[model samples]
Target chain A: MKPKLVIPLLIGIAFLLSACAGVGFRSDTSWPGLTSDGDTIYMAFNQAVYAINASNGNLRWSYPAEPERDRTYFAPPAVAEDGTLYVGDFTNGIVALNASTGAIEWGPIQLGEGDGRIVGGSTVTGDLLLVPSGDGRLYARDASDGSAVWTFPAEFNEPLEHPIWSAPVVDGERVFFTSMDHNVYAVDLAQGGQLWATRDLGGAIADSPVVVDSKVLAGTFGNELVALDADRGRKAWIFDAGDWIWGSPAVRDGVAYFGDLAGELHAVDIRSGSEIESWKQSLDSRISASLAISEDRIFVAAESGILFARELSTNEEQWKVPSRGTFDGDLHTDPLVLGDTVIVATNGGDPLLCAFDVENGSERWSFTPGGSDKRCRSG
Target chain B: MNIGEIWDILILNPMINALLYIYDFLGPTLGLAGAFGLAIIVFTILIKVISLPLTIKQQHSTQRTQALQKDPEFLKIQKKYKGDRQKLQEEQMKLYKKKGINPLAGCLPVLISFPIIFGLYGAIIRSLADSPSPLLEFSKHIYSSVSSTIIPLDSQFLWMDLGQPERFPIPALESIPIIGDGIPILAIIVVITSYLQTKLTTPPQPGSQGAGMSQMMGIYMPLLIGYFAYTFAAGLALYFVVSNLFAIGQAVLMNRFKSEPEPAGKKKKKAEEQPKESGVLSLLASTQESMMKLLGIPPKSTTQGSNSSESAKDQSEQSGKKKADAKGS
Candidate 1:
């Protein structure tokens, strides 16, 4: 070929390669959004959503059959009582699939005028599915037909300045959501009107606000865990976490347990916004995922791919498991504990899902979509 | 530190903080709706201004190289050492040294520019963190100077989401089957501006080696950049468009002010030889010539001009020979 032609052809090939490798505006690195419906676990990863048998970690079915370019699934699949799975994609598309068969029941419905992306999972509230979008609007869609029922702020023109990257939590008649705009909002679930929005909390909230004891507990990037009046959206109190908290606190009883990006885990009394003494522990890596609580233990997954289970009563490390091999295994998703098996999803790992015995952190099963020899082992 | 860490420290982190700071100031203080986009524009302009000296040096170096390529002595040296690569390089270096030109001077700014550009691209992507993991990673790169309130920079600017590839949806055009979804307006603009910048900066020399390379660049650069604009985030595309426009303006201004003046005799001769076309027709013809030139297609008028210059050279040579003969007699 001519030299001139060769250079352009080379560039064209590079672009093709980069596109094929998913090198775009956003880096293709995210923890799998894992959820369980008791019998089965549904995982939304990079390109497709997979339904695995909760018992043996065997793949039951994957949606779309073939992964579509530009369509990535990251939000956890929200399974309804009737076994209908509602999920959202990075492309602002929401779809309802039959959980048993992985068949699309409704939509691939494009939301937010094809601009906003669905980063957070949808919450199924009776007949309404509340979806927090990257466009900063909490869309309440009809759970049956996927039709738009109402949008938060009610007014179509006014949206929160920043994206809502966390799911909305429903507390009775109101839906509470934390925004990257540094404000937590309470919207009337039925009318989708804003009841109240909290004053700027000094940082962006990237996780769902946990409601316990009539208080909305949220961790912020401002290095503080803030509790607000769940009924009125007023600031209750703030406990400095000393670092940015990326994950929501897993509340058990009146104590809220959470981890910060600085790798410190704290058990705080949600009522007084005071740190529970002797309940703090530090990990080698950052804790970017929400903690999972079982009957006697709380499972914490760190960014270093280490999963540590601590006894709930004494906050002592029960067992620690490190993801095997050199697989860019980073745990940034909240682990789900079902029965005796505690399942953890990894970011950029060979085994997308790893299950361990809740008692001793023994490997139960490892599931990688393409099949891998690696296993999670106790260190 | 690893390469990734080094990159983060040297380029990515600083850029992210810069963008965040700018967004925070512009959005709240100025009350700009598309504050993030404005921040990117301002950032790009600031970078261009900071690197102005380097850019000007590169431009001067390029002009010098072009002038050298046209020099008769340089052409003779090249022909003499056509079969001897090492000798040709040595002679070229000697001539370059004599002319006080650094052949690699033009490449220095370009090499420096690439990192800054890629860093900005990284910054744009990192700053507009849409998902949890990326957002988590982004938080680590934030400097203490940037306020925590500006954690999530608004990615929306006008109709474009700065995070995604840009496309403009025309409702009226939506009925037109193929392009119903949206048109990549930014990508199209990128291509046009890229082509224009490449063409305007490259001195047109038809049939020359430099011309062939320049022509190839003119074709390839736009397509390459256009593809990126179409594929990557709208913010990066916006950067490309703004950067290309800035470069073109700089080149045009430099050409206007720093171009070498023609001799009075030649200028007079050129004026006398000009075709007396009517006003409107001449204006239209001139526009057509300019368009052709901008597209890197040597205009017919320019070819005629080249012919006139060659004739003038021949006449001058003949006159000098005659004077030498008269002195000999």
Candidate 2:
């Protein structure tokens, strides 16, 4: 063959190989975004937001009706008191859909001129819908009309250097959120005025800040779980987890239960930031999602595709179920517990959402949009 | 281990760490703004330097092939063995051996660099972990030496969110009719630089069978790269532009330092005959002339000087032939 043709051929082959390897030029990937309003659970994954019945796992309705190629829905939807679902897409656009009929209520209103994305779910507090954008601004829009109430930075020109991937948690009058800039910010819920921002937590935070007992608790990739004073944003205490923490700790009573990426689940005293005695369990699988706590049991989803239910008091494993025949069975989103069912979303699995019995490790029902032959089964 | 595992261990992991390390080091010094972009530029240059020897070898092989194609003896052999495929192959091989040229030499370095280029592309994608799942995947590949604090490398470079396809918005163009949306400036630059690189590095094939293929390659490569630049992340597109410029510079430098002097007799004969213009140069000139015509500007008369030179050489040739005829009588 001609030597001149070889380089182009090699480039074409390299691109093909890169595509096959799933390491294409566009580098974004996300797990399903799951949220619940007791009776219905809204799941945002790939192209459309799915509303599934919490009781029977039946499809209520999906917004957009047909999937869009350009738009992707991965942020968990924020449901208003009026039964309007407010969700953001990866294209930096927000839309409000009627919960019952899945009709477009207001928008697809674009934010930041399509430069940034909305990775974290929005929050509906009172009449205000707090949307955390990847453009590093937490926007407070009116829940009724999807109109902008106030932007966090105020100055549109000076935005945060990094994206905000964590949802804003509203506590009373103040709302707290985490940014990839390695800081936790507390802003006024009404006017979007910044109250305070914590000094760099030494690593980026990808999960929402949990406001518990006058302390804002957030896990960071800095290998520690930090507790800051809710008002002043001063560091209250830090619990070293031995590895990067990617999920917010499940706070129950006075203890925060969370797992590190190294698969070690620890129960830490939320007041003192000290680990509880003999309250650490190693699952031998990476845990990148927040733990879900019900009455006495805490559900832990591992990257190895196994879901384990452990006693919250003793950190002892009660029952473990392996999500088999799915795409790696990888679970990366926070699990939601509504009554007897604990629901978790998978990363590119056959069934997008799966629900298991909270009492026993049995599969109750699995929900996959656009029904698949190979359903996700637990063993 | 599987191929994927091996690739991650050897290529992807190291590149990821290198990018993180560079970003971390530059964060404090460079003020944390556009540091990741600077790191990418530095990393690309580092890869180019590491593969310099292979690139130089490829350049030398290309130069030798071009010289062999222009050799009078090789042309005579091709003419003599025109109807015989076996004889042509045998003579070509003999001439190649006598000239100490390896026909396959140019391909080996390109083959070796494929993994590096592909690995770099993967590293850029993995490094710019913009979302959750990608960040989780990226976390597993971090080296112990590199700090986890750099979990999310800054994707902001100038007006670009390096993770997204780049566009430069012009507020002034907003009032205009059609192109009110932001211009894809990076993709345009990618096409231009890719074409320039292909033209500069691709040794001028005059009348060889591969000349048309080479010309087609010059057009297709830029379009392919431009398509990727327009659709993919801006970071990868930035890599393409920088790599193309670096390769073009390297080719020019290699050509300057490594070119052998022509024989005096061949030089004089060449001067008396019509100068052989390279396929790439002529194609570029014609393209420029066509664009000029389309824009209603008459092209500068480039052929006038060449035409006068050809006429003077033709008159000198006729005079020499007449003198030779007189001697024969």
Candidate 3:
């Protein structure tokens, strides 16, 4: 070995190692994932699930109710018919909590050798709980006992790296879901068997598919909104966007309202798969949160923390509300429309729960969960 | 397109896609932790193998330059053109041209391989993103086939969280003295292996000018990598350890091929000609010399008026007798 060889190699290795070191400097806070049932809002932030009052945005009780590193929540909590809230953890497996009391109902269920972490929230149909995991399979578990009912890749395909990321959308007897594996899968809800799979859409589908009318609509990394026949798993039509479509489309009447990764809000004719001429407006930022529709107004939040309220009929901008604080921008959770108020959660750097009036987009109340002061603050 | 966009499409995107494909194929049986860890080793080896021709050329050029430095006449030439750097460079180039050897050939290949290695480091960080925005950017770069196969790669390998720095296995372990839970085991391994690899591969510079600098780098490189390993994810530290060991093995095999075995009598004669020193002191000196060379520092001069001249004479010869006399004085 020569001194010449050693010098250059060391420099190269040093560069490589330095690049690896950058991973540690990243912030620990994660984007918020929220879901609401009636007057209670379930918010998953950092590592815990918080149950907040929907009306004034106040904390009710948080599951675990304390910071714990051994477990972490990545997906928004899903509420079941029996008042059980289901959520996925980044380290620990799926758990069922009492939605009313914030108490553990079933688990830290070890899905696969106590190693699997769920990426999407659980979709409960009847007694079955479908959880999409980083393990490249969707585990169908008994909702009551947290026992495995079935798995998508029963034999486990080692070559296919496709891990389900989107939550499974249940329609009638079939459950439709999209995966990084590039295809939309239609599985039988009762049997947990593959019913039909759409052709690869040339991109990864990270958001859950929405079944609108007779079609299943999904956004993709390919920068297209694809609509497939719900029954046959055939492509109905596709709407091309300027950038990758990450947010799931919200359907109202015959039009689908969604925002792309480019932050442009678009309204498309669901039947014809054409962009509505008057309903397109550029928001000038990236949008990863799904749209929330309430009556004639459609609410959407951007990653920059700007919340927009637009008219459903003309796509006219109704009112714009900036993020609450310097720390309260970078919203990732979908805006939740509860009666006359619209609620949106923030994960820019700080964790905040804010509510605004639907008519004028005025700040009604803002709550910072886990704070000593749990009451809503005036704007 | 902007510079950032161009870089994304060219270096970053390709590397990310390649890594994803490798992870996908290996992940099923190995699990994600095993798959990614193994994939890095394979990718590194692949890069080495692909650049073997260039490496060989670089090796040849360096060896040729070193061999020319040994020429007694080359030393005389340096002594003659001591002060005039321009004439010294001219003479050296003339000599290289006559000998048909390229001094820069060695550097070009290493330079060429740099971007690939750099791009690979970025790809690993971006691809293994545990958050939303980076993942979104990662998604855009991946090919449909590779993207579809793997998303949200499992970062758990053994007890290590590949996405986080390696620490004590449990909180209870922190109570232990000295080697507490805060000590990063993988980082320690990385530092040790890097030091060993550098020590094993560094050829003695002996009287060369860069010897001291090389010795310093031997110590510095390991510490630098150790710091990175301690700070970054365990996955990267794992990559460093494996890559260093592999490099050590490659260096051994390459050196074996480069140098032929001498007869016992010749070896004895060569050993007898070497200067004698106490075993421990000589060993320590040799270690320092190795570090100096690793950092590209030149050694101090022992011969009168001929100290910096050796590096200069490797390029060319003096113009006339007048220039030679001036250098001689």
Arranged by TM-score, best first: 2, 1, 3
Give the candidate number with the greatest DockQ. 1
Give the distance in Å from residue B197's predicted Cα in candidate 1 to where it truly belongs: 1.5
Query: Which should have the higher DockQ, number 2 or number 3?
Result: 2
lDDT of 1: 0.81
Runs with alpha carbons beyond 4 Å of true place in candidate 2: A1-11, A17-21, A25-28, A111-114, A155-157, A323-329, B30-32, B175-178, B261-329
lDDT of 1 by residue, A1-379 (tens): 3446759675775665353322243456466888888999999988999999999999999988889998888888899998899989988889999999999999999877635677788899899999888777889999999998998755447777778889899989999999988999999889988899988998999889999999998999899999998878788899999888889999888999999988999999977888988988888788889999999999998888788899997889888886443224778889999999999987867777889999987889989898878766623
Q: Please provide, for model 2 over B200-265, each residue's C-alpha lDDT reduced to its tens digit, 9 standing for 90 to 100.
A: 678667877788778888888798889888877889889998998798677555543442334467
Can you tell me the CAPRI class of model 1?
acceptable
Off by over 4 Å in 1: A5-29, A104-114, A141-149, A155-157, A323-327, B260-329
In model 2, state the lDDT of residue B68. 69
Better of 2 and 3 by TM-score: 2
Query: What interface root-mean-square deviation (Å) does model 1 yield?
Result: 4.4
Q: Could you tell me how far off, in angstroms, the CA of residue A196 lies in candidate 3 after the best superposition?
A: 1.3
TM-score attained by chain A of model 3: 0.89
